[model samples]
Target: MATANGKLLTVPEVLAELGGEVARSTFYEWRAKNQAPKCIKLPNGEIRVRRSEFDRWLESRTEEAA
Candidate 1:
């Protein structure tokens, strides 16, 4: 999990960062499997992901072309 002090992105923002191709349901599924970037749940149950952590996560999933 990342620190909360960093910029926090909402689920929609995250999706847009992913090019607006991934559905919300699919993202939720990734969370359930713990395959997505670490997220923070606020007191009001809103989900947020740190910008740095999200960038790291995207890098982790990248595959170099052969």
Candidate 2:
């Protein structure tokens, strides 16, 4: 669940709050397509996406449609 400020969100947290519309596999698909969100890759290979960058990406989609 998101906090009131939404300072951080995990992958599942994002998918769950969005009603499971995008599956975990889709993240991989986007990566394969070179369209995944800006991700930080840890030395152990874990990925952490920044909420602000993601929101910017989301907002750009809206601007494109305008």
TM-score of every model? 0.90, 0.66
Provide the global lDDT of candidate 1 against the true structure. Answer: 0.92
lDDT string for model 2 (1-66, tens) is 233544555667556755889898997688779676666666787665667757766676664434
Name the 10 consecutive residues with the lowest summed lDDT in model 1: 1-10
Q: Write the per-residue lDDT of candidate 1 for residues 19-49, one digit (tens) a residue.
A: 9999999999999999989998999999999
**lDDT (CA) per prediction:** 0.92, 0.66
User: What lDDT does candidate 1 reach at residue 12?
Assistant: 96
Q: Give the TM-score of candidate 1.
A: 0.90
Please state the error at residue 7 of candidate 1 in Å: 0.7
